[model samples]
Target: MKDHPLEQVRGNPSRPLQTIRQLAIDPEMCMYALTMSTAESKNIKEAMADSAWIEAMQEELHQFDRLQ
Candidate 1:
């Protein structure tokens, strides 16, 4: 019979939950979706001062360049 994939890695069912949790949170295999903030900046100065907003802007510009 063919062995289950998880069983092949873990060898036993003693810590299935832990194994699953480790796989779910593994950095090398997992990438989180980028999230945008709902908060609005009053002006350019305010938006530019916030690092998160700056990063979001850079990512948007990168997408434009990548598609073109």
Candidate 2:
């Protein structure tokens, strides 16, 4: 997996967390629930660390292609 362009080169761990917070504000993207599952879980941080962001972006791009 790779890192999403928006997630690329996150200066620090907080960066992704911030982005996640911001995205959550978008009503359209609200369905893409990204939050801590466990009591001490940190899904945003894990997303940044695991490079799931990139994979998600890639998936989104494919979805766009299919529509065309």
Candidate 3:
């Protein structure tokens, strides 16, 4: 789950929605997807509040793990 060291991730608080979506759906952006914690970041809760976003995240997770 560790991100590729050569890859750089940037977050844009100015666009909370977009950032949250990316965080949840784009596992590559995170150095360790399974280790990424939401306890310190409420953005995920805010994003998952929308059912559509939740579903999207689920789909992406499967894709990332090749367990779909």
Candidate 4:
């Protein structure tokens, strides 16, 4: 699997919940993003409307899609 960009913010205290939110909010997107299972995508987008990393997050997704 490809490394997740979220790893940049991983050490942050919110990493755990952020991970949960990502998987919970968008399982399919998460699967595609991290090249990982929905159970573990290292994290993806959230249900909320305002994510500062949303853009970077989307870019991280499918980046390896065609390659894979």
By lDDT, highest first, what's the ranking? 1, 3, 2, 4
* lDDT scores in order: 0.57, 0.53, 0.53, 0.49
lDDT of 1 by residue, 1-68 (tens): 13545422323345444333565576543232111224567899988877677999999999999999
Worst-scoring 10-residue span by lDDT in model 4 = 36-45
lDDT score for residue 19 of model 1 = 38
**Candidate 4 C-alpha lDDT tens digits along 11-35:** 3434344455666688775565465
Where does candidate 3 have its weakest 10-residue lDDT segment? 1-10
Give a tens-digit lDDT track for model 3, residues 2-63: 34232223343344344556766776655444454332335877776655567778989989
List where candidate 4 sits over 4 angstroms from the true fold: 1-52
Instruction: Give the TM-score of each candidate.
Output: 0.45, 0.30, 0.32, 0.23
- Residue 60, candidate 1: C-alpha displacement in angstroms: 0.3
Best by lDDT: 1
Which one wins by TM-score: 1 or 2?
A: 1
Give the Cα error of residue 55 in candidate 4, in Å.
0.6
Better of 2 and 4 by TM-score: 2
Q: List the residue pairs that clash in candidate 3.
A: 3-31
Candidate 1 lDDT trough over 10 residues, lowest sum: 28-37
Candidate 3 lDDT at 62 equals: 87
Model 1, position 14, has a per-residue lDDT of 59
Q: Highest TM-score among the candidates is held by which one?
A: 1
Clashes of each: 0, 1, 1, 0
